[model samples]
Target: MKAILAAVLGLALALPAAAGVTIDAFKTDSGLTVWHVEETSIPFVALELRFKGGASLDAEGKRGAVNLMTALIEEGAGSLDARAFAKARDGLAASFSYSVSDDTLSVSARFLSENRAEALALLRESLTAPRFDQDAVDRVRAQVVSGIRSDEKDPNAMARQAFDLRVYGAHPYGSDKSGTLDSVTALTREDILAAFRSTVARDRLYISVVGDISRQELGPVLDTLLADLPETGAPLPPVAAPAFDGQTVVIPFETPQSVAMFGQPGIPFDHPDYFAAYLLNVVLGGGGFESRLMQEVREKRGLTYGVYSYLVGKDGADVWLGSVQSANNRIHEAMEVIKAEWARMQTEGVTEKELKDAKLYLTGAYPLRFDGNGPIADILVGMQIEDMGTDYIATRNDRVNAVTLEQINRVARDYLKPEQLSFTVVGQPKGL
Candidate 1:
């Protein structure tokens, strides 16, 4: 056991030094793009399938259909029932996870090299031939409804829902990924089937594989896994026009502490100044204790225990959002401090010292993310989805390092809007 532990630690230490890891990328005859990183240290593989137009493809009045369909894909498929499918996966010692966010429905699996063929076959069934059985659909729908009912009383959930509704208005992004109780309860087995057929297709698929797999071997596997999916998915809705009027909307939840979620339109990931704005955001709120918001709101004034902000560049819209929680009486004070800091950042930008520290932390911490095969596969697929080039892994740190104080200040002024920032406070707070 000691020897095995030492070998694992040794491998972990050695992995960070392998900076020359190259991704082998190719397009299949069916037009699916697959990225591979051959890590031969373990006899295993981590695979991901990202289908675009996730929840955004839901038809009107059937808001949660796509989400429900995604959750049910692995419930059963073809000849296998839910119990049988679970048993088969356990027998092979493989894992499969199915989920959907606003923009993508992702299926991920990991398996030993010896069972690669079996694992891949199981995954193909889940994606291509999901049963969406009536019993299973009812069961999962009940689960979803339960979750929605719980979220109704959750202050944090209430704040997020209120914030998105205000910011995105009638757009699909305004709604929670899990549909409302009424919408979800209305979903039927046929709705799930239509959603599955419309969502899983080749035109918008993204693939990434890591571990003991060779390019020559992965080609046929890719073809087989995706062979049954349609050529194109239902077209996604147009890009959402996120409407933020900068009003401070308050939801009256009975809690001693109030939670505030705030943000406005943010720069897209593809924007030229994205990295600069990203670094600026780190100084503003993305960085934890070292960030300006943490310093002003918690460290100096003692208003709250934590506060943070981050960039949200979804496929349909981009945003900069943050959250904080404080006593109902002091929540308004917290908002004041946040607004002051927001304005101060646009005016003064980050100091040279702040910029240096942010760059050092950002650049140094990046390589740690590539330590394992599964994480590496995720990052590779994410880079491609964001349209970051194949060579991004090698050049990412360089880009972070290249952001000058001038660039950051320019982006700060352009992106930060104190007056246009909207706040959604959940809880009955005095002095709002």
Candidate 2:
């Protein structure tokens, strides 16, 4: 009897577990895609809205317009001034903010379910009817311009900007996500309004709501908030894959630590090999102290305090980046170590122990990403924007676990070529 009972228990444990949270997704009548995760454990709710055109959609000469427009949305919208907007949101104890990334513009709000009406009202105003007051635009532009000047003084920032220019060339991805000082200075209220009008259409929008709310309860709220938005806008043109010619960009800078950035074109988000590439990056450099790059470069040689690598998966393109900082004298050695590691991974590949450890860390840390409503909302929005299925959270572990040694080696051979990488070192080399 004991043996039989133990057998049954073991079999049950071996079965794949279901996701702790389940997402119910559908499209709103307004042509907005909505994803809902209902968790009554908390009394609060979180909402996130994503729009297609981010910095990548900036016009040829109007680089910072999208970003500046996103900021101004929260500054004043509908009939409220910036001060009135703040007071109203604070009175309701709601948290509302907007941000523009390379690929998307997002607005998020977290508030008690009791205050959902007010929160949605404010969010709706910010989304569809932003004032874009001239005063607000001028104020935000000054801040953006100041930030650009500040970046100019930072060696690491200079290194990355140079790397982007070299790796991406004339591609839109090559331009700074934050506009240049000249570009920001050239921007006007007209530019911001035009960008907002062109980008934030209903069909291009995705909304995700998580926390103590059901789709039935939330559907009406969404309808009311998004009612004024237009159903469609101009579809974004497809972005081409960045071609990386083996080039070295050396930008002279006076800093104690030389910043080195290097990378090759990588797989986009929708690629079949994405899971393999993701796991490979973890084993290569994304795993912090346990990563091969950190273990090889910093621990053994004392070359730098940290070294890391990652993949950027955008709507139309992707790129791999590896970065480290070291004394000017050690920059070449550091680059050699990076290149050697790349070659080794491509040829010899990772061992079972390395692969297993990476899987453990990735799976174990996955739940920590949901510690707050804000992060949970962000993840949901990202899934909708990336076209990743609602089951992504549930299947993410399986995806990482499915990456076999054979798959790793095959992907490494296909994607990780050392000679094809472009290197950018920003600082004076000791003997250059």
Best by lDDT: 1
Candidate 2 per-residue C-alpha lDDT over 1-432 given as tens digits, one digit per residue, 9 for 90 to 100 = 234323433442333333456788886665557888786755678789888867788888888888888888888788998888888877777778888877788888877777778778887888877888888888888888888999999998898888877776776678788888888899888998888876787877888887778888888788888888777755674676677776677888898878988888888777889888888999999999999999999999999999999998777678898899999899888888898999899888888888898889999889777655556778988888888898889888989899898898799888897888778889987654
lDDT of each residue in 303-362, candidate 1, tens digit only: 999999999989999999999999999999999999999999999899999999999989
Q: What is the C-alpha RMSD of each candidate to the true structure, in Å?
A: 2.7, 7.9
Candidate 2 to truth, TM: 0.93
Candidate 1 regions with alpha-carbon error over 4 angstroms: 1-20
Query: How do all models score by TM-score?
Result: 0.96, 0.93
- State candidate 1's TM-score: 0.96
Candidate 1 versus truth, CA RMSD in Å, comes to: 2.7
The prediction achieving the highest TM-score against the true structure is 1
